[model samples]
Structures are given as structure tokens and as C-alpha cells.
Target: MTSNAPDSVERADVVIVGSRCAGTAAAVPLVRAGHKVVVLDKARFPADTLSTHVLVPNGVSELKKMGALDRILALNPARSTHLRITDGDMVVCERYKPFDGIDYGICVPRNLQDECLVETAREAGADIREKCSVESVVWRGGRAVGVVYRDPDGEEREIHAKLVIGADGRRSRVAAEVDSWTPYRGSKNGRGFAFRYMDDPKAGTSQHEEMGVYRAERTVGLTLPSTPEGRVLAVWMCPAEDVSGFRMDPEAAWQQKLDGDPVMADRLAGAQNMGKVRSTADLSSYYRRSSGPGWALAGDAGHFKDPVTGNGMRDALKHGRLLGEAAAPRLHDPERLDAALAVWERGRDLDTLSTYHWGNRESRPDPVSDLVREVLRTFAGQEGPDLSDTFNRARPIEAIVSPTHLVKGLVAALRRPGADRKAIVKQALGELPLEWHGRRNRLLDGFRSTRPTKTERPDWTVGNAPGPPSYRPAADPAPVGADVPAVAA
Candidate 1:
């Protein structure tokens, strides 16, 4: 390891690869510790990412922790609280009113979001490099030492640091260099695909009806509560095996299928193409066999569950923070670096498996969907809360995105003012189960994972899917395991 003499000629205190949510999240804490940090990535900021574009309240809180909430709120894309969706029968369920947290997270384009944090890291004193791709891991006695990357100009450089962090996306360059990955699991654990679009907003509606199938049977799409009007944002997930056809005529196929969609068809009528549809076909899940030996993995490097949960970005943030905290003290306790990572892995593993299990099980829920309808049936005309701070808390997205169980799902469609609880009722058809608390997960327990292991996805994992219009934590330290799951992997 290099000397930590404040200004050592040999290296940085930390080296992070990739500058997405995970990398930036880790950079925040590291910079605070005064570590010389270098964040390397192949893509520059302001990238147009294919994400659903809805930030959960918890994600907003994380931004606040990183000192980004103020700027974000000022640039709010659009805040939505309830979701109005029509069944195959053309029966529409009103929005789900969040009984607890912000009805919806402010929706900003992914490109803008990436730029926000990357700039934050630089302001906090991190060396930021774009168009830089890592080549391999530098090691000393099987322990990490630094990283080797190719600069944008195609020149190779060696960066030696005490702690090397690999926050690259799903196809992590660092993970490939390290021989410590476990399979993503079964058949479902293979490649997945996704693509994005800008959308046209309906006159009076703001909170995007980010929609998923009752049990995630197949297609996934959502109309985000965002800007650059006349463009309707959406995404569709498919297996990698079928990507060949989709890539051949991405825009055409996307337009055709979406225009053929019952709900999205009308929404897209006024919206034109804001950008070309892009796809990330290799999206899948995998975990490091170990997160030790002086090296650590964050974000996609550690796990890659399907976006069916809308938690990848959130997982990256939470795990990145945890990894950063564990790595921070290492500048002073290099000998215990391995131990610190072990703890991070244990906690993160449980968290990832829990989310994966539920996400996969929730793939197609016709039975439980009925139960959810029963729940939304409970909060038809009640105003949950009315404070901006109350809506920005880091609560679980379950209450906001419940499956076939559309009660709390619609009733809890928490968003900013414009449409009150009564208006939300007039707009939709169902609710997420209230459970004296929030959405129910028991019906989805078994289906979470194809393997159905206890370790992967647990039962009643997180309690009461937080209420709408109150995203702020009623308590502190961020809900432990309650509302954080929607954002976590």
C-alpha cells in the first residue's frame, strides 16, 4: 500500500471506476474524508440513460445527503402522487394515494441526474475523468492496489491507490479483472433488455403513471411526470436472447408496439420522438463471491436484479454509501479493510436477494392482484398529507408501485398538489392493500425468485409500504428496512 502522507507521490487514497449513481454516492463520503479520489468512466456526464425516471422519496433523501436535493427540487421535472391505469377490460383504477411519503419522487432525465452528482463529486474535490475505461485491477499479494485504465485519448495509464472501487455498470470492467463472481442464478438470471423515450404530458396530469403488469407478466412501461413537453417517456423490458430483432428497428418496433398499447396508445398520440430508443440487453444479476482483499465492488458489479423493481439505482446508492463508509477508515486501518468489506457483503447480499426474490416472484401476479384491489378499495377519498418536506422522505416505493393489488397502488399515488385525494379517486380505479399500514408482500413471497430460497427473498420483508404525500421519514436514520427497499436492489 502507498503511504497516506497527505500528499504521497505514489497514489490516491481511493480509485473509483464508473461515475453513475454508485460511483458518485461513494465519492461523496470519500471526498468528505479528504481522500484523494479519482473517478474514471467511459461515458461523460449528461448521458441519456434508459431509466423509468422516477425518483423515490428515499432516493431524493440520498441526493440531499450528497447535498443535491436543493438543486433538484428547484429543477423539479414533475411531481406525481397517484397512478391511473386501465385494466384489459378498459376499467381504470384511480391513482394510489401514498398514505405516508411523497406521492412521487421528482422526475428528472437520467442524463441530467448523472451530471448532477458527477459535478457534486468534483466540487467536493474528486478528480473526475470522462471517456476513461478501466483495463484491469492492480494487485499486490492478491490484495487490490490500484487500477489500470485507458484514457479517452487511447493512452494507457496505471493508477495506484490504497482502495480501488469498481462502480462501473452491469458489465463492470473491474469485476472481470477480479476472479470472484457468483452466477446470477437460474434461467431468469440471464440477460434482460431495456430502452427509454421522452413523452407528451396529458393536460392536467403530472405524477407519472409508471406502470408495470399486475404480476409483471411481460411488458413494463410508465409515463413519467417530466418535462420537454410533447414527449412521452417509456421503457420496455425483454430478454437478451431476443435483442437482435429489437435492435434492428428499435424506434419502429417501439412505436408500433406502444401505439398498439391500450393505455400508452392515447398518451403517445401527441408526443413525437424526443430521442432514439436505446437498449441494454445484458442486464442481469450476479454478486461477488467476496468483497474483500483490499478491493470492493459497488452497484452493478455486486448485483444486477431486473429493473422490474425500479431499485437498481437505489441499490447502487445505498450499497455505494455503505461501501464508502467501510472504505473510509481504511486509509487509517488498512489492515482491517478485508473485514470491513465482509460486513458490507453480508448486509448487501441479504438486501439484494430480498429484492430479487420479490421482483422475480412479482413477475406475474393475477391472484394477489385481486387482493391489492381490495386494499385500494380502502382509501378512496382521504387526504394523506400536505407538506413538501413530508413528501420528500425516503420511503419504500411498494405503496406507490404495488402489483395486481391495486388498492394502495392507486389510492397511494402520492404526488405534489394540483390534484387532491378526491381528484385522484376520480382519475383511477383501484388501491394497494392498506394492511393497517401498507402494501402486502406475502402473496408475492413465493414468486419473488424462481428458486424460492429463504436466504434470497424473505417474507413480509419490509413493513407497510409507506403512505403517500409523506416521503420524509417519520423517524430517522432512514427507515432501516421499511421504505428503503424500493430504491435498494
Candidate 2:
């Protein structure tokens, strides 16, 4: 598409790039608050991604808050769950309950999920334009004033707005449009390696079902919910550069590793090749800040993690909600925009930072992979399924470091061989270090932050626009395009 014609001067309260989870979620909350929102995306809908397709419970909750939980459930993506951690011949499932009741997350194809959400934002009155690439961010007096984008018709156009948001994914063009963002350089998001297909029938499988992260000592495989014919599965990793072989022949690379490992190979049996056997270099990464003057970033644009935690979409949803709530007060007062975003940053920074580091930890297994698997399996029944979160959060490390608090743990270890009780505890404590304890959730003397969930009137809709944006680009040329300093306030 071209640029926005010189004749047209578009107006919006908020303009967002990327229309998946973060952009859509941000639009909904702002639309309810009566903001005129425009969501621009460089790609069309129903796009495929290197995703495991699982929505963690927290991811589900945020979608629920955005009024998408029921709709998502109705889509009937496979609902299978529980992590099944296998080490050699032993299989153990450890459940990590951040809250209650939900032991597993939901699984849906990335294409279907993104499409559903873009449509939802449309219903809520967001001017969603697909296949439109943003050229640059327009600035006024050194502050973000609007955006200059290449429209679907291959024309250039500018959409004036009170604020511009980088809802774009990890490698965001909007983020590049900002000055402070320059110092951040490139994106912190890692590369993602994944492949999916309908499960081959010959694996001697049970009824069609979706399983959450199934981790072995060296690799991880995930199954999405069952499709009409079968289930979708993907084996992915976020390795630190050295495991660079995946960028070449991913299929061969994956095969070599999976085939060498008996457990992972078992997970791949009867796996039919479906779509593109590719990798996404722009997996999620941690960002320095969330907002600046007249702009804020959400979802992968803000922060993302390796797929090991299976929380990218979940983080997007939660962070988007927070962004919406932050922008709410600013929508009316205008003067409070910066302040509001600062509050939102304060509310989310710690949690996301903690999650990213944890995700990095899970990207690759440690030296004692076999022993770790044994310990997890031995305690499987008592814990939930899937040790991705367990491993990522290093819950086992916490248990060992504080052995005095874990009754029966020594006995449980004693039942299994190659175990040294006190020595193991000492090793764990030494590895954990003392500084991290400061980040642990502490017993507050008073109360938690009382942030309201509903930042605006739910009855409002951003999708109420007369029609979707089909901005025609101009034949002529026009060039374009935040300090994230210490939170916005």
C-alpha cells in the first residue's frame, strides 16, 4: 500500500501498530474509555507464528478481562494440558499453581487466535487496517504527534493522534521512530525455533488432546489442541547464540537432536509436516521501559520471553490491560497521560523483569539434566504436570535452599538413588545466592496495590468506526519519526 494522500488528514485518540494480542487488547480498553483508536499492521490477518499455541491461566484471565475469554473458549482449540516431564524412562508431571483451580493453559493455533482477536477489536470499534506498514512516527515539537504509514494501496498517509503506541511485535518500527529507544539498539527478543503439524496416527496415541510443555533434559516439545484431523505440535528453543545451527536446516537440526534423545524422539513420532518448517528470530525479549511522551509500547513491543514459559500471549494480555488502564485517565485529562503510564510501568516492571530472567533460565537445560528430571518425576503425583514453569522459576532451587521448611523432602530424595541430602541443599543454596531473595515476594505489612481492572466503561467500542481503514498512499514522498527515562511520571 502507498502513503496517506495529501488530501486526507486522519484523526485518532490513539494509534497502535500490530493487531494481535497486545494491540487488540489495548484498543478494547481504550475504546471502552471512548478513545478513537486505529490499529495498523504490516501483515494481514490469520498469520501463522512460531507458537506452541498454549494460553497460560494468567493469559486466559487477562483475555477474560478484555471480554475474550468466552469467545476464545468457544473456538474449541484443544484443551489438553498438564506438563509431562520425561527423563530417560521416567515421566513425572509437576503442577505450578500461581493461583488455584487452573492446572493447565489453553491451546489454539496462532493464526486462529490472532484472527479471532483482530475481529474482536473490530467489534469493539477499533479501526483495524491490515497489510499497512508504518513508515515513521510524526513528531510535533519533539513529542510524538501522529504516524506516517504506507497504506494498503501503496500510498503514504499520516494519522494524527493524541498518542501513538508501539503495539508492534518485538522488532517494532514504531519503537525505532522514538529517540530514547535508539539507545536500546536492535531488539532484546531472542530467536525462536518451532515446527508444527497434525500428529501422525501411528504413534499409538490416546484420543486427540493438547498437552502443555513436555520438557526433557535437553529439549522441549509442545502440543496444541486437537484439530479436526489431529493435534498440532512444536518443539522450540531460545538458545544463546552458540546453538546457532537452527538458522540453517531447521528440520535436520531438530531431527538430529530429537533422534538422539529417546524421550524427545518419542514425542515426535507420527508427526506430520503441516506448514512452514521455519524459525522466528524475533521471539520475546525484555525491554527497558514501557512508555515515553505521547507513546507507550505493549506486548512483544514492550517485552517478551522465550517460548519455554509459554507466556508470551499471556504477558501481552496483562501488559496490554495495564497499558489501557494507564491511558484511561490520560484520555480525558490529557495532562495526566505521562503520569498514568508511569504508574502502569511501576505496576508491571518487577513482574515482567522477573519473568524474563526466569524464561532465559528455562531456554536451555543445565549440566545435571538427568538428576533434575528424576527429582521432578519422583515428586510428580504431588505436583502438577509440566515443569517448564517449575524449572523457569527455579522452584526446586527454592525448596532445596530452604530445606528446613520442606518436610518429607529428604525422605522423598532418599527413596531415589544418587541423592545426597545435605550436600544437595548446600549446592542449591550456593547456586541461588542471597541477592535474589530481595526480589522474592515479601509479606507486606499493609496491602497490595489496589489497581482497578475496569479502567473505562465497557459499553463503549472502538470498532464502531464507519468502516475499516483503507488509507490510500500518496504518489509523492514524505519522510518521518520518547525518553523511557525512569518511568513516565
Candidate 3:
């Protein structure tokens, strides 16, 4: 073990990597609690990344807690009270109900959102160093003690701390260095997305606050109102195989596709493209181990679901706050801190699993069955809080899309003139089923199973020393496991 004697090395109570929503959110609570916190990020602030900018009411609540909601609202983000979606000939407009007095969603761009969060953390006393990249973790006595990083000038430095946090996005370096294993990984949907900002005065109708989605046979179009008065975001998501033609001549391809779509064409008639079309193809989803002896992973560093559902920002904010709450009180005791982190990690998986599966089903390139269409139609026509709950994320997804509902919808579809019984039956039985999910997970475990490579393993786990004690809590924390599965593993 390295000596703890005073040296030129800097130190803190906690060292957080990645100063985006997740990292900044976690730092807020810890620093406010009087802990010496330092946040490191590879990029400078006020930067933007590829993202779906919708924030559901649940996420708005987190922003409220951090005192960033008011500042976000000042950015002129369009307030959305409902979601408008269409499938075939059916169109559903579901309104969002108020949650704790927050009745709407917002479309704050990442540039504004990330800046606000990092600034908030700074105000709360967190030392944020931008242009600093963490190269690896430093270990002492089988536990993570610090990190080795390159400063802005490319000078290597060591910073010691009791705990290290990974808030980096999907390809998190901290997670790799700690040997975090992915227990579940969702299959690719073979879909790609191209989006651009636009100056469309008439993009939205009915309400100033609503997300408009149009669905055709194999494509989906979205019109999201952004901050400025006449600005909006227009996106088209389609099969990966179909994206190449669109990429050939982006402007012509985008306009052609828009004009061809039954719904989107009319709404964007006079809209002028404000920026170059940005495209993304590889968007697979997965969940990684959240905590180890003295290290924890938060936000996308640990779990990422498809962006089709517009849940990425929400998940990052919610999980970051939960992690902060869980770890703040136990930072001084390794055993207790690890236990708390384990609970938070498990809860994150259980809470997000249903949505993860839902996104995969929704993003598939295959056409929806007649039964599925009817199910959506039926839910849209219903008059009650259920529809609101569905759109606002107040209810568990299973409650909205249950097996019983599918069976009923299947029966209805069977009566349709051109219903393909085989396809509908196959979809009803196979798509989004829990059993199917379990099977895929088992299959992935086999394909992904292997001993950690030297570069990916921790110091203790990398060397001959027996691997760090099983982080799986020796005694399950009763409070944390009340509703989660036996083990997230």
C-alpha cells in the first residue's frame, strides 16, 4: 500500500470523473455536505454532444431539486404538456399530468443543460477542472485510492481521494479501468438517426408545448420545439440500411423524405434548415456494474437505454442524484459506502429494465403488427389519468403495456381483414416478453464472458493477488433490496 504521508499530490474526499449531468449532479450533494469534492472532465464546459433533448417531468423535478430548473426555463425551452404520436391511420395525443406541481417537460439543449449543472456544482463548492483526462485508477490495499490524469498542458498528475466516481458517458474509461462487467446488454435495433435544428415558425400546432411524432411504415419523424421563438429540432429515424441514401445528399434526401411522409411534410412546409444534419448509427444499450470496493459508476457510465424513448437525460439526472444521496452519508466507512453504492446500483437497473425493453421494441425496424397499432389506438382514446401517467412516466411501463393488454389487442387484430396471423402471433408472443429478455441476456453472457484483459482489470484483480472481496454485499442491505431482484448480476 502507498504511504498516506503528506506529499505534493493533491487530495479530496471524493474524485469524480466526467463533469456532465451525472458527475456534476453527484458533486452538488457531496460538496454541499462539506466533503472536499473534485470533478474532472476531458472537455471544457458549455459544449454540446449528440443527444435527444427532451426532459420529462420526472427529470424536471431533479433539475428543480438542484435549483437549475428556473435557470433552464429562462433559456426559452418550449414547455410541453403532451406528446402527439401517430401510427398508420391512428393518432394519439396524451397530456402530461402534474407531478409535485411540475406539469410539463422541457427541451433544453445539452449546451445549456450541461453548463447550468457544472456551474451549479461550482457554486456548491466543488472544484471542477476541465480539459483534464483521467488515464487510470490508483489502488491501495485492494481498494481504489485515486486517479492518474493528464492536465490541460498534458502534464501527468496524481490526485488521491477516498472514493472515485465514473460519470463519463457510454464508453467510460473509469469503468474499464475498474473492470466493471456488463451483466445485460440489449441488441441493436439496426436503426440510425439524422437530425438538425430548423427555423420553423409553424412547426407545432394546438399547444406551444408538445412533442410531435409521426410514424410511417419504416420511419419516425420528430418535431421538438427548442429555446428560441422560431427554432425547433427536426429528426428522422429509420433503418440503418436506409440511411446511406439519405447521407448521399443530406439536404435533398431530408426534404424528399419529409415530403413523402404523410404527416411531417405538412408541418415543415416552409421550415428552413438552421444547421447541417447530424447523424448517428451505432446506439446499442447496456448496463454495467455500478460499484466496487472504493469506486462507483453513475449515469451513462453504468446504464444506457435507447434514446427513442427520450429517457437518456432523465436517467442520468435521476441516477446521479440517487447515487449522491446513497453515497454521501457513508463516504467515511468503506464497508458502508460500498453497501450503499451497491443498493443504488441495483435500484437503477430494476427501475430502468422495463423501459430498456420497451425502447428496443419501439426502435425495431420491423413494422408494427395490427394488434400493436390497435393497442396504441385504444390507449390514446381512453379518458383518464392512465394516459397521463403513461406519458409523464408516473406509472411503471409494465402497467401501461401489459401481457393482458397485448392478448386482448391480438384478439382484436385477428378480426382485421388483412391481419397476418403468423406475424401478429409471433410478435405477440416473442416481442418484449420477459422470457425473451432473459434468453437474450443469457446468450449475451455467453458471448461476452471472458476473464478481464490486463488493461481492463484493476491492480489487485490484474496481479496475482486474489481479486478484491466480492463487492456483492455479504449481507444485503434490507432497505435497498426491498423491491429489486435477488441480484442484479
Mark the 10 consecutive residues where model 2 has the least summed lDDT. 473-482
Model 2 lDDT per residue over 279-396, tens place: 6544433443456567777887755566766667877877787788779657645447765665565556555544554455454334334334444544555454334454223343
Candidate 1: regions farther than 4 A off: 1-9, 49-52, 74-76, 84-86, 89-103, 182-196, 199-204, 207-217, 238-245, 250-252, 363-489
| Per-residue alpha-carbon lDDT of candidate 3 for residues 266-365, written as tens digits (9 for 90 to 100) | 7777777568888776566655666777888898888766677788778888888888877787888887787677777767766676576666666777
lDDT of each: 0.57, 0.58, 0.72
Which candidate leads in lDDT? 3
- Of 1 and 3, which scores higher on TM-score? 3
RMSD of each: 11.1, 10.4, 6.6
List the candidate numbers ranked by TM-score, top first.
3, 2, 1
Please write out the lDDT profile of model 1 over residues 135-205, one tens digit for every residue.
Answer: 88887765678887789899877788888888986566776566434332321323345456555546355
Q: All candidates' TM-scores? A: 0.69, 0.75, 0.86
Better of 2 and 3 by TM-score: 3
Query: What count of clashes does model 2 give?
Result: 34
* Candidate 2, position 302, lDDT: 58
